[model samples]
Target: MKALIRSSAAVSAFILALSSSGVLIAQAATTGTTTTPTPMTSTATSDLTAGPLTLTAVPSFDFGTATLTGTTGDKVPGSSVTGALKVTNPGQIGGWQVTVAGTPFTDTSGTALTGTILSLDGLATNPITADDSTNTSTLPTFVTPETISTSATVVESAAPSTSTSHIGIGSYTTSYDAAASSLAVPSSTVAGTYTSTLTWTMSNAPA
Candidate 1:
């Protein structure tokens, strides 16, 4: 009986030792456990700028040579010329204007041609054309020379974003049709080459 009891005690001691070993192994596994994570981010931006108002002169007027045949006090043979002006208004909210001034026709000897008249026709923001007196649709005439001349509303742009008729921010062109007439060539009129100068000015202010 005593030997049987001793054998039962030894079995119980072995079972308890096995349970302790399992618990120690579980604690060792948990001690080295760890985790980590990283965060990310980003950013963005934008900017807008306005452009400047500017003007550019295009081709000049060239009145080809002509021979005078009319009697004194009568209009003589003359020529007509064509030219243009270009304007750029980037982001402009208002309208603009263009003016033209011409010097008197003079010879190299500084002799001014008297009784001469210059006429401007087909003054428009688009392609310019000479005015036909017979056609009332043509532009007005500028008889007085050497003066700052303004045409009808060349560019009627609408207020910015207020109306669909406003001129946009971009380049615009204006063409001019011009004609010149010489007053009667005096019987004593000299035979020589003549020349003149035309100056163009532009402004944001309405004319």
Candidate 2:
């Protein structure tokens, strides 16, 4: 009876130890941890650009009316007229120039008036507040009254702005004066009005 009881006690102790070892192994297998990596990012950029250059003219030049009291082959002078012209440059890096040309004055009959002369002078620019290095020392000068020719004449010119990065706006005001002389008064001088047209051109090229 004592030997059987000792055998039963030893078997029970071995079973309990095996059960505890199994439980510990199972808990250890489930105790591990895990983790994942995160992502990262960024961007790039630039500046806005400028637009094209532009030019405009206003107020047609009018020499006004004239009365011819002189005799045949005589020359008569007419009153002078004044007007303004504007130039706008947005993104131009270089300089600019302006020119003008006109057709001959003619009567309603399309008869080209002989000895007709037109003169342009007194060129002035506005916003003289800033100094431009490229400007001419003297403004354009047209002393002699020139007859209407096919070729155009340069009236004004300005260089690239040294003070500002870009030329914003520039204005030119000029005086127009004219004179008419009778080369040979016909036996019958027509009685009517005379008219002519003047065209102005602006160029990116400097004068």
Candidate 3:
């Protein structure tokens, strides 16, 4: 069999003489490398196990320190914490919800801010991921302007998912603005450092 030389060298063939069997004999010289193709295949596989459907991050509220003017005032200014409430879904076949409750604001001396309330306004859902393939409709639902109290109130929720459909199958984030996050001080309020505790809970909840 004859094969073509595929290299950067010149090939030459010269007729030398005739063979004893009445066949023409030739001499050939070739330089450089000859290449032959060999096929190669690669295989790879992966199994995606289920991940936990839960809250990934919860923002800490810091209404900071406030000073009282020796008289009755509606609200007082305080510091702010920068963050957003975050939740993640593991493609679970169930729904989920997040609730928030807060204890009354009190001073170091246990003096409660009786009529004071902590509120978050301009509440809304934000896109958790910037992936172009993410579906915007699957983000979680939320209730806005929450005046977090002692009772657990649902702030964000998601509908149940089925075998073929998903309501909240991706990560979600809730954005809230500081509208009026201050404590009210009455004329009788004792001037001192005050603090409050906020509790955020996540659980499995269906539509």
Best-performing candidate as measured by TM-score: 3
Residue pairs clashing, model 2: none
- Looking at model 1, residue 68 earns an lDDT score of 67
Clashing pairs in 1: 121-131, 158-166
**What tens digits encode model 2's per-residue C-alpha lDDT throughout 1-207?**
999999999999999999999999999888967778787677677765645555555335455554555555433344544444555444455666666776766888898665555554333322222224554333322222334344676655656644544342333334443332112223344545767687777777754
lDDT-superior candidate, 1 or 2:
2
Clashes of each: 2, 0, 0
Candidate 2 has a TM-score of: 0.50
Give the candidate number with the greatest lDDT: 3
lDDT of 1 by residue, 38-145 (tens): 778888876656577676555365556656654565444335444455656655555555566667678999997765544444343334332323322222122222
Candidate 1 segments whose C-alpha is farther than 4 A from its true place: 1-49, 72-83, 123-164, 177-189
Rank by lDDT (best first): 3, 2, 1
CA RMSD for every model? 11.6, 11.9, 11.3
**After superposition, which runs of candidate 2 have C-alpha atoms over 4 Å from their true positions?**
1-50, 71-83, 123-148, 161-191
User: What TM-score would candidate 3 get against the native?
Assistant: 0.63
